[model samples]
Target: MSVEHDKALAAKGRHIALVIAATMLGWLAMSLFIGPALGLAGRYALLFDFAALAGFIYAAVNIFQLWRMRQDSQR
Candidate 1:
């Protein structure tokens, strides 16, 4: 049981890390290239910013959950 729980935690951690990395990189790419290439206005760029913000928030919540799970498991 403990082994399975640990594995699940590891998987969750990896997923959260991936989400954070992807959000940052994707936001950078869109802001730098896609937006300018498409000639998006400032308001339109905010859409991407908002999307990135959501992704980061999701990752943060998941990370907190994972931390709590780890703490409980340790105890």
Candidate 2:
């Protein structure tokens, strides 16, 4: 029972961390790239590149999370 609870807590914590990380990345991209490219005033400079970076970051995080979950479950 305790183990199950611990696992759930760990999973939730990881999920929240990932969510925050993604959100922060998105905001950074918007501020530094998307907004500028769109001429939206809130721009920085890395538009298309930012988009690519965002996608890659998301994919990497998912892969890492999947690996983590798999290892945790094996235990």
Error of 1 at 13 (Å): 0.5
TM-score of 2: 0.51
lDDT of 2 by residue, 8-72 (tens): 75786677567657766776777776676788742344454466566667757776766686677
lDDT of 1 by residue, 1-75 (tens): 378997999899999989999999999999989999999998868999999999999999998999899889878
Clashing pairs in 1: none
Give the winner by TM-score: 1
Candidate 2 clashing pairs?
A: 32-45
Q: Over 4 Å off in model 2, which ranges?
A: 42-75
Lowest-sum lDDT 10-residue window in model 1? 1-10
Q: Each model's TM-score, in the order given?
A: 0.93, 0.51
- What are the runs in model 1 whose C-alpha is more than 4 Å off? none
